[model samples]
Target: MHTQVAIIGAGPAGLLLSQLLQGAGIDCVVLERHDRAYVESRIRAGILEQITVDLLARVGVDARMRREGLPHDGFNLAVDGSTFRIDMTGLTAGSKVMVYGQTEVTHDLIEACLERNTPLVFEAQDVALHDIESDRPFVTFTKDGQARRLDCDFIAGCDGFHGVSRRSIPEERLAAFERVYPFGWLGILADVPPCGEELTYSNHERGFALASMRSPTRSRYYVQCGLDERLEDWPDERIWDELATRLGPEAASHMTRGPSIEKSIAPLRSFVCETMRHGRLFLAGDAAHIVPPTGAKGLNLAASDVAILSDALIRWYGEGEACGLDGYARRALARVWKAERFSWWFTGLTHRFPDMDSFARKMQLAELDYIRGSRAAQTTLAENYVGLPLA
Candidate 1:
């Protein structure tokens, strides 16, 4: 089989790219190792920047999101028991964020693909890229116990961190940067209303905690935990108690406690692979970079990557312009690194380091204090939180 672009992974990045390219009359095929059920059910980042929301709308997948997704003009940051709001809309000239689950976005994109009769193959195993450094790139995989090969002009590695895309590039061609935090986030999802109208990032002496939601009626909460902590050690009751204590009395007053429907511990890490593109093969989303969730840049950065890539691909096919494609890595990495900086800074400010002495702890508090009092600092946070502009 042959297509213009052979995309690996039916995740949001690949699916969105397919939609964008198809809209421009460019054909592509999507391959996923997991079934549709698995891809759509995966719980992930729930915040959407304006850029992502606009792209969803551009692809005609925003009907359900428009009806159900919550939009917030700002969010809260708490130090110990005191809380303050960063007015993102005001600071960034009316920019805001959408509170929508990544799962829903994936489901919507998949439905759009199926409705449009796009070639999206699930359960594709052993997917591998070949001749990526050449213009005639192709992909090989197996489906239903039969081997298959797909010849294409380009390949998109959206299969995520563990996928075969990044490894396909020779080690000498890449530079990797990573930092694994000493703690993980022990999160719980319950059928209850959120404690506040907007999301909250709290820094207490105990640890860091986050108050977020999937919808108006489904609350998602997380507290910092030791890397070695086990699920068996944190029951619903214990998790709620920790949340109440760390979030302080004001948020706890409105907080609702209930049985958790989902629980897990996710370790925090900041990772970035330089040069997101190599020859005819390009990497987007988790395949190229990962940011700590503190600033909610993960999915949004992916959206921007594909948006940039789709434009480049469209121009290449339509106008015979390869400039965008040639500059894809440089443009995408510019935004990626800025986001990495923000997520790293935000994580350091809100989380308790294992080796933090009194002075380090005091420095964190002092920085938060400065942010609370300085409009310039808040504006910087609001601009990044709302998503930076495309390069």
Candidate 2:
């Protein structure tokens, strides 16, 4: 098969890119290693930044989101037992975030592509890139016991961190930076109303806890746990009790407890590749960078990457312009670093480092105190949390 662009991964990043390129009259195809059911069933972050929401709207895939997604203007940051709300909408001049699941966005984008009869090949195995440094690049993979090849003018490595796209690049040609947090987040999904209207982040001597939701009736909550903790260690009663204790009296009073339908532990990490593009192969989303879920930046950051890539591709295809394509890596790296900074800083502020000395703990408290007492600091937090503009 031959195409203008061969996109790897059927996640939101790849699917959204396919929709954007197809709308711009550029032909592209998406290849996925997993089937549709597996992709949609994977639970992920749900917070949508303004840029992501707008892109989904522009692509005509946000009808359900706009109708069902919760719009949160501010969230509570709890220190010990005290809670304070940061008015993101007020601080940022009416900019707020939408609470919507990444899975739903992926599902919507997939449906949009399928409805238009765009090519989306799922269950593709052993996907590999060839001759990426040359003007013409192609991909090879197996489908149902048969080998196949896709020749394309450009290749989009939209696959996640473990995907083959990044590995295809030579080691000496790439620089990778990563930091793995000492603790993991233990989360549970339950069928119950959320504790309140907006999400809440907490800092207690026990650790960090978060109260988030996928919908009005389905709450997603997380509490910090040991790096070696397992789901078996946290029962539904224990989870709710810990969440209530960490979230404080105000939230605990109104918190509705229920049976957990799903539970898991997610390790936290911040990783970024030095460059996001090589020759005709451009990387987007998790393939390029990953942020800890602290600032709710992972999925939104992916959307920004896709936005930059889509615009670059549109410019190249529509007006025969190469500047945008040539500058993709630089533009993406700038924003990637900023998000890394924010996620890293937030993680430090809200969690008790196991190795933190008394002095360092004081410093952390001092920083949070400054943020709570200073509107300037709150504004900065709001700006980063709501997301910076796409490069």
Per residue, candidate 1 scores C-alpha lDDT tens digits across 192-240 of 9999999999999999999999999999999999999999999999999
Candidate 2 residue 290 C-alpha distance from true site, Å: 0.8
**Candidate 2 lDDT (Cα, 0 to 1):** 0.92
Candidate 2 residue-wise lDDT at 110 = 85
lDDT of 2 at 323: 93
User: Could you estimate the TM-score for every candidate?
Assistant: 0.99, 0.99
How badly does each model clash, as a count of residue pairs?
Answer: 0, 0
Off by over 4 Å in 1: none
Note the residue pairs that clash in candidate 2.
none
Clashing residue pairs, candidate 1?
A: none
